[model samples]
Target: MPVVLLLDIDDVLVLPVGYKRGIPATLETFTRRLGWEIPLPTEADIEWFEAAGVTSEWDSTAICLAGLLLEAARLDERWIVPDFDEAMDRLAARALDGAQIRPDYVAWVKQAGEATRLGERPSQAALRLWQREVLPQLPRSEALAALLSALLATTHSLSCPTTAVFQTWMVGSRAYEEAYGRPAPVEVPQGLLEQDQPLLTRDGARALTAVWYEGRLAPAFYTSRPSRPPLKEPPPPLPVYSPEAELAARLVRLEDWPPVGLGRLFWLAEAVGLHENPTKPHLIHGMAAFAAAIASVDGIIEIQALQSAYETLQAGELKGPLAEWAEFPWHVVLVEDSVKGILGVFRTVRRLYELGMSVRLTVFGIAPHPGPKAEALEAYVDRLVPSVNDAIEEIVHLCREG
Candidate 1:
């Protein structure tokens, strides 16, 4: 069987510098251009929002919009609830759950989510805001689109052999579909065309099918019961005067790293690789160094409170096409750019393996940031490479060896 190279979009096939730079401005533009009276988040707020996104329970853009709404309401007496802090907490909780926000904010949040999830063209609202508020200021969207197109073409050439048996499916995050654009016939290179046979031929390779995101088909195509795993018990509090606690304290004061919630810190400390402390693994050591660079101004108590709520959030389960894909006799490669992406891929691989599937899983950690608890992942995935091209080369070598 031909190897099925599952790709990731952001930071994997395409550098995410556009996303990293454009998103904040996108959020600000939404508020200003749409007349939503939402207050702009401070740098501290942005850090908190990004940290929350690591959980994957909430879409990062949605959380950004929710934070702005809550902050705006908190500052303006006219928009304030009786219990400002409590209301803000409730909003944060809802955002993490991926619940649609109030109508005024929902359109922008939905648009942003769609851009990331489906790779759909920017919504009118997003485009208008960008043109008016962001385009003149900064131009990253065009570059992002060009990079996405090139990635799609490259993936097609690598995975879809001109003559072969078995199908090639693109299994990835919502953003993975951005290259194909909602499924029209894609033009293959002239060289590939010469060797290509009918897609349905018994001995011919199947044309690439741009379907499945996060292991499920598009929402419109299929619906399944939401997988709600039981919540894990919260980690015990750090002991006062311990080295762990001291390190946690120091992490919160750093100016460069995103503001990790105290609960996340505790979780990180107990997490397999991070728990090793002084004699830490490279990935863990890298995380500690990162945390020191961008410590938050928020106090431990405040972060702990946010962490308490975050703990209650549930992550969606992988099902449908993704699960089915695991059963196929294909070499599966997962490419991701963040610690969260690596961790999620690891969990999926473990689950598939437990189900008695013989999966040859290789993970590519593309341009992953320094911080994040990803050390244990190296053990779960068969191989970890630095880039997509490296991953593709590894896949080719593995197939030849086989």
Candidate 2:
């Protein structure tokens, strides 16, 4: 059997400068709206959050904004400021170290339930902690509560203000309105999405393509980015602003491959009532990526049928082509820049092994620097490389030797 490769999008194949820059922009938009300016998070601060297992930029934006509100409330409770806005003003006045923000925010998250630690629905966990701890200490003020509510609100669509603002930063104002059916509060002619640069080198692309064509490697993508709904027919033209795996694939000339993204998960939620997080380090996402990769190899071109195959795998009935995958010895290489993706695939591979499937696992972490992300990756991944190019080059060489 060919080596099955599962790749992550952000900080893996692409630099994702868009998302990295958008985090602080999202924070600034929210804080300015609340009538005070505080120190925005730096890139290192963002890395700290990712290393701590809060991978989704949406959740990161929410947590940072919520922490700001929590700080304001904390100051008000201590009589340091007369009002929330004044408290924010006081905070803005101090040269607060951005590095301290992650620790304080993480402390609040640590107080939440067990799911809070491993990139599980952390925004929701932070909300519960706030309602239980901070909400009670302050005098009842509807406006303040409403601001916090907007910060923590969840929605299937882009109705949540924080999500809406982040989308605007990502896709621009015009495209944002078209996708979500509402005018963006912020207006920019061009989106940061266009600014994202591909990280894969030419040699890496050629090596990957050669192995893929030589029947030595099977590959697919798994990511949390919202995507177009899976359809039985060929996917439609890219929307004005869709940062889906399809977009990433196009950047690397691998658009023919399949990716199991959040859009597919949203469709599953509506069709089968599968309400699991459906993102790494969650098992459902790992299984879905596995199914989609196999489907690509089996010529299962219909998106709906690929989803059905995933359901069959979940049911543990390997009656059809899924059984064929189990019969062959397979090497599964999960390539990711974050620990969550590696862990998710590890869990999925273990589940497959329990079902008597013949599969071996290798986790490759794309960590270029000695930061918190690299440190976290140390715990989960088998090898740490600087980029996907380097990882793919090594994998290709291994296939040649074998």
Candidate 3:
């Protein structure tokens, strides 16, 4: 068994007072972040902040990530205080935080209610319907909480070892909301609720998966969001399944993993080899095979391995024979919206290889030409060709420098 500390950054640990949508700190917020406010970025603020050179999320993520690691180590503050760089560089997921429910999942859930009154406006309709539709999806039934405990345990173990993910806010209630755009039907205890803790926050703290730090898995953190204002301003923390409650959830799903909307999964299957009628009864057969093929990447499951597994699934899902993976020079392809100008880069690729200077990544584009010239790859490089060739050379130069 393993325990993992999942930390979120938006409203749990830091936030800006009047941050505008799509804009980074207004110079004022920027200054305070370095000193006082831990600085939580709104969903839109990440990109805006990234470009403005706010400390890399990785850097800040490391410090917070170490908190749980410290508690787990039993060595406490001093041990974690020194390993900031390694933790920042290694402990955290690059972009694994926040939550947004898929719209389609809710649509399916709500369809069951005939003429159900949700609301008139789109926002209100969705919220009201989710209350009716999504609440039933996770009702506490026979052993539901217990099964959740095991899954949470497994997830905790996997989070650090296989693409370590400490979601700044991967709350169960959040997952409830992520799946249905609303909180879980469960209520917060009166004591926790009285302190002004959000039901989501109160619920998530309970949901953290527990782990034994006897070096069973690599050292990892397991804790809840500290309620202090500065440390608690980021996003809410993800919940863990208390061991008992978790086991209950597994039993709840025992009949099967409740079918997930697999449009993306379906699309991945088609691309990978999932067919309606296939020689194989199942597209995937094992967790390892499935994990090898599909993994949580950048906070989303990438089904590449699941598809790759299809090639091997015939006898058993083995990494397909090398011939299947062998990369050949791709055909000169002109895709939709393509102009004739792409050929210039193709020519440059051919030329560079001939010159014994093959590019690792080939690129070309039209430059802001002073004027036009003979349409040719050489003409572009020579600056004697039209905007197309000139663009190619400039593009090539930028690519090389980049």
The model with the greatest TM-score is 2
The global C-alpha lDDT for each of the candidates, from Candidate 1 onward, is 0.31, 0.69, 0.24
Give the lowest summed-lDDT range of ten residues in model 2: 234-243
lDDT per residue for candidate 3 within 1-402, as digits (tens), equals 111111111222122111122122221122232232233334333322222212122212222222223222232112222232343333232221212111121222123112223112122222344344432453331232222222222222223211022221222334434433344433212211111211122222222211111211111110111111111133232222212112212322211111111122233344555443110112232211222211321122334434444444344323432123223221111110011122322432343234333233222222222311112222322233222222323332332333
The parts of candidate 2 lying over 4 Å away from their true place are: 75-120, 141-149, 153-156, 232-243, 302-314, 317-320
C-alpha-based local distance difference test score of model 3: 0.24
TM-score per model over all chains? 0.34, 0.85, 0.20
The alpha-carbon RMSD values of the candidates against the true structure, listed in the order shown, are 22.6, 4.9, 25.3
- On lDDT, the leading prediction is 2
Poorly placed runs, candidate 3 (over 4 Å):
1-62, 65-322, 325-328, 331-402
Error (Å) of candidate 3 at residue 55 is 13
Clashing pairs in 1: 117-174, 252-296, 254-294, 254-295, 255-294, 255-295, 256-293, 256-294, 257-294
